[model samples]
Target: MSVSDPLLKSLKRFVLEFRTTNIVVTDDNENLAKLCSVLEEIFQKGIKKSKFFDKSDFFWSWVAKLPSFSKERCNPILSMVIDTVKESKKVTLDLGRGRLFIRSALMKKVLTVPVQIIAKNRQLAREVYYENDSILGNEILAEILQSLLFELTEAHFQLRIHNASFLDRTWNLPIYKQYELVPCDNLGLHVQYINGFLLVKAVEPGSVGEENDKIHAGDVIDELHGEALRGNKMSAVHNILQRYKGLPVHIHVIKGYDSQGNLYKPIHHLIEDADIDIATADELLQVKKSTSNGYKKPPHTILNEEEAEEIPVHGSEGGASHEAHYLGYVSLGIDGRVVRIEDSVQGVLKNHTQRVPVRIELTEKEVLVIDIKDNKTLLQHAYTEISACGRRTDQLQHIAYIAGETSCSLAKKFNCYVFEMKTNEEARFALCAIAQGFERTHLLL
Candidate 1:
């Protein structure tokens, strides 16, 4: 309960040893082993901890990479954890499968207990070091704490998305299975070009595309307005849309399906060709022939002799830059990371209850459409109300609150739209129209 508690003490010791002394304990490190044991006990013996592993990437990553871990570990551990949690009565673990979360007053306290102790010591050490240069402690303790907190934040984000898996499963699946119309509003739909195909990523909920079921995530756009979109970059799609601003555009899409006509779900397949040890005689022959024909090895390929050890190859879900204005009001990082939809604007209906795609990048510039799932309830509130889009021309200091906070809040009532200006002065007009249009429609109080 207190920082002086035995569990907290052990946690602090582990952190200090992990950061300061590096005598190379690795998998055999007693401190780390003890820490893992403690975590295992908490997960197994503590009934309230059952929801910690549900769809958690951090938990899954640890389970996948740790020794003596298996799916079987879950059932018994979860059962015990539940009982322990119920008996203690100190913390209440609400098993919310719909949101895929374990909510308890003690959960945060438990996770942060170790970090808090280390952080306090770290701050003291920092002050001591400033006064006396010989003072001890790792300089990177703050970074470590920050990293741990970030992981917690990311894990929470993942859980929310997993709980809201219905949108993609029920509504969006139809569009990918059969042909559907994707609405392209005044801003545009979010998309990414991958492997010579353009796929729709997100759509605003109340927008024409979403309301009419014109577009859906995972539908591959093969052509736009009779022109083949294959092999073209996202810029090309932008260009074609800009060229014909208001015309009824015809888009041909390759619905997600297999050659067998079975519905295709997104999957991660192992790279059989990447396995060197399991090559057959025919495969060896092909490799020899290919080598003889002047095939050069890839640049990053290291000779086996120069490598210290073989690093296991894992397949990635893939990554790409994503943006969508057509779906419930959402925006992404220019680099394509999913930015929070609710934070984008007011009245845009920010539902932290749903799951939007967090980044699942494979290579630096590729994204597999299947990797992104469960995004319907996200930003569902702001579909039809957006009246105008605009860019903030003010200083950066004045922009965050005005653009992100003020404008979005205003949009909820007036249905005004504001967007980052990209060589277009139209959004400014839209902002003005929002005020004028509202005043014209109703007498001011």
Candidate 2:
């Protein structure tokens, strides 16, 4: 989100060092005033450095219109401005009441510590933050840094990881190509100390180390920028690299661990199955109805001869059909409740050869059904288990008619009218009711 403009960079740098520490854009330009207002807000809010310029896009566009404000002539100044923004405590220039102040008390303290030292520290902090990407830094420490250094979480401090590139026979080492125009500052390499000694834990892909096929996992960082780095912490190595950002530096490494293993791996996650059924609505309603009748009726098996004769072993295959998207199959309990949902419904369906029988029912808001794939003859064999205490057609929220073959092997098509349920609880209750209804309706064959 940086401006990437030279004149603005130079202006900022000049303001940073100006004795009076006040920048007053004398021109009666409204854009200039608007620019100052944004700078004030940025100082107060202290947004992340990467997103700082996002809110000032229009102001930077105005800078582009300034005469003779070419980026090439002021490249070095731009670099300086960028470096200050990254490392310094807050921006050097402070705009307030239509005036800019540069020599803030915080800026004075940082200036006392040589620019290179501050830059090196900031660079190391940035790298460490990226390495421990998921963890958040301490908020109190962040305020103290004033944007110079963000505090690290304790978790990152515990892990020992070394980032080093190695040259070996297993990796076909190639001589690094020379780039005459731009200095080879970013070799895309990082080094570290794992265990007690220096160990190379990571090598970025497509970097100088990886492309040259020189650096590999398990390599020890022997020296950095010509200085021996044995037994040194990764922070020390970061300091060395920081001072030579745009320069080519040689790395000496000793082979250690095998180069065959991957340097880094992705984090894994575990998915859990949904727990569906808990209680049934019919049982609850029966208990309520029994309580209202003055005395609790002893639970007894019903022997309704005429009603029992109507029970069919299996649902008729030839029924009214409807084209509807099949969401997935669900299991219902005795009182009409959803008990379980398949992990990969489509996957199971695709592998299944035969149509899975399901008894459908309706809840207060949604439709509920049971996948009878495991119990092919549930309608016939399980008919005797359930009690026919009571039946309420008004409680039935929906009627899902069999529309097509229930086998999952075929492509998905609308085959049933699924009644809508207001909530998951209603669906679960409805499922249980339908399950009980199925048993009550089936014949004992």
Candidate 3:
């Protein structure tokens, strides 16, 4: 469908609702008759997915706020709409065939953002939302669409973490100028159709590469590790960045350059960490410990509930209530706004399948010890399934045994993991590890 189809329908519906007799035959008599005919056809046709089917009634509550609209006169149309959508078993089956709905989550698309039209053409509309929140609704469609759009627009705002806070990039000199982004968790050093952002977590280590030189926990991250600070896709630079933890990246005061330059800016000089007393103290301890997940060599390892208990607390504070705050963030790069995990539930739509999170981020910046959180991270991690099969990431053959199905294609479609209750502990860990951080590749065990 052409993109204009959506706007066209809105146009037709808006005209019809004006009920101006001079424009057409908008008479109380004609309206009542047309309304009846329209209603009859709708019930008979079962609400065809029309280009002109203005779901006005769905958002009519907000429309009602308009002064010209009359609740009394609009009753007939509203009544007819309600009766039409109030479905019977056969009607629902015919309407929503092949819909993969999650239990308790299937919601009517009823939320509407109240936006005042600006400018003459009404082309500029801004959503009205509370100062503290974004104009997002609780639906997968909104999640995907809004997130995609947000990222696309956000990519334009080049971020600069100009924290000359740390004065130590003694190693090989800070490459603030040689800027590029390697793929991160869901983002590869080089990837296409990136759904997440160029998540840059850096710290300015006091020391250098050596543990002594290596920036400590309190160091401030200078560059997004030398990224141009984009929420869009750019492959001119390298695609993968690894061993990022415990490394203090240099800060380059990179200014946007001519498109002709290939975005290569020489590293800027180091910024002094003048008075980082407060910031330094705050940086030492994360608000909460991250959901720590790593196992000894022997892949597919498992340290289930019983084994996990003995793990001691890392620091002194052990009984804290608030652990950490983590939120799922996706970036569409240039596309802006979060796109739907196009195939979040790709379990062979016809067959059942499973997938695991190669990496789970329970905390963005927190250090909760096992004793303090009582393994809450593990609980949340356990519930974290490979919710969606990404663009082309596939599964492992062993997953076939877990799913007990001959074909793996089913699970491959949704980018999900398949695990069994009867599996051993090691198998569980493998799935968990992939869910935590599938480095260089996605493990499909």
Candidate 4:
């Protein structure tokens, strides 16, 4: 039989789990030879004497060599292999979920093969065996052994350790910067605690932080408003920001990159001794309390009763709406809004997959797609017209929905509208809102 035939048969008969088992073979030639001998016996039994052989044929033949290879037999073989390599002081075995992941404790190299335990009747069992790849020749076996042992030897480990220590001692340097930032729209800074410092993860576009040009993502905020941020919880940072709301705050940051623009070594290398602190409810409550009392309208500030009543707040009773900025429809060729569809809107969109800036708004009864620059409604669809709406997983920051064209009855059809959001989280939120709109419409019906 051809190689493809038996491989197809095996796949159809048994579910091939792509899970792996890792084993670290010793650098010793004697142990490697013994392991190769055992593997050769299995491969010779399965492979027919032929000039040409494929992976599928080799795999099936190996399986046939141990038709009754059970969990009991699997453990002993793995233990024996482990014992043979134990003298190297680099063997580590991780067994779980009927799988094994073997690797050298000191090296980054790894070899993965399926080690599943199945039944004699060609049926899958709860266990697995390490079976894949044929022991074709001594060269192949020698190559595999060499890869596992190349950097795992004692001499290599000692040399690497010495080099790393020398570099750390001689090249370590500190880079710092100070910024005076005025708070605008919540400072627009999102931070995460990493390596004992509050690392700025993102800076919101158009915010004061971004406008400053000095503050940036990846910079570690070592001190905020005269308070050292290191060894402090995120809540502490929040509390400090809240206390100094609407005021220019002084910030001292340890630059993630050096003066030469190259990233610092500590940013990429793990610091084993850094302590990561977890936030508690008390800290969260303190942040909320500080925020509530942080901002107060000036004594001269006053609002008319009508002005107060007319001011729109999101999610309010008077038809409040949700809006998000998106890189507009991929199907639309032009950057501007589609004010009128002289031809088929679907046809125009289907012609190309280009994106432009747009603003999406969800109102009481309709969804409006507007051009960001012109501020004109390009396309409007009622909740009832929407056939489907969802965020695309393939493009994490993209959202897609199918809606029927209400205008131009001559060629009325459903168009797939695709828009890319600023972030995946925003895309997900937009999808959820669209789903809620559908649900509300269903309830009204």
TM-scores for every predicted model: 0.21, 0.18, 0.16, 0.24
For candidate 2, write residues 378-409 as lDDT tens digits: 22112122211111122222222212222212
Give per-residue CA lDDT, model 1, range 174-264, as digits (tens): 1222221211233245566554445555555544333223344444565565555656788887888665432223455543333333333
**Which residue ranges in model 3 land beyond 4 Å of their true spot?**
1-280, 286-415, 421-424, 428-445
**Residue-wise lDDT of candidate 3 within 186-265, one digit each (tens)?**
32111122121121223332111111112222222223444433333444223413433211122222221112222112
Candidate 4, TM-score vs. the true structure?
Answer: 0.24
Candidate 4 structure quality by residue, lDDT tens digits, 1-445: 1223232233222111111212333332123323323332433423333222123323332332332343345444444333333322111221110111122212222222222232232232111222233222222332443333332332121111111111212223335555543222255677777645566666665454554244555556767666766567888878887665433346766555554455555643322222323222233233334434664321110011111111222265423333444433333232111111212233333564556567777766667888778889877887666644543223555566556655212224666576667776566555545544554554555
Residue-pair clashes per candidate? 30, 30, 63, 11
| Worst 10-residue lDDT window, candidate 1 | 299-308
RMSD of each: 23.9, 29.7, 25.3, 24.1
**Each prediction's whole-model lDDT (CA):** 0.31, 0.29, 0.23, 0.41
**lDDT: the better of candidates 1 and 3:** 1
Question: Pick by lDDT: which candidate is best?
Answer: 4
Candidate 2 Cα deviation (angstroms), residue 162: 20
Candidate 1 accuracy as lDDT: 0.31
Comparing 1 and 4 by TM-score, which wins? 4
**Residue-pair clash count for candidate 3:** 63
Q: Give the TM-score of candidate 3.
A: 0.16
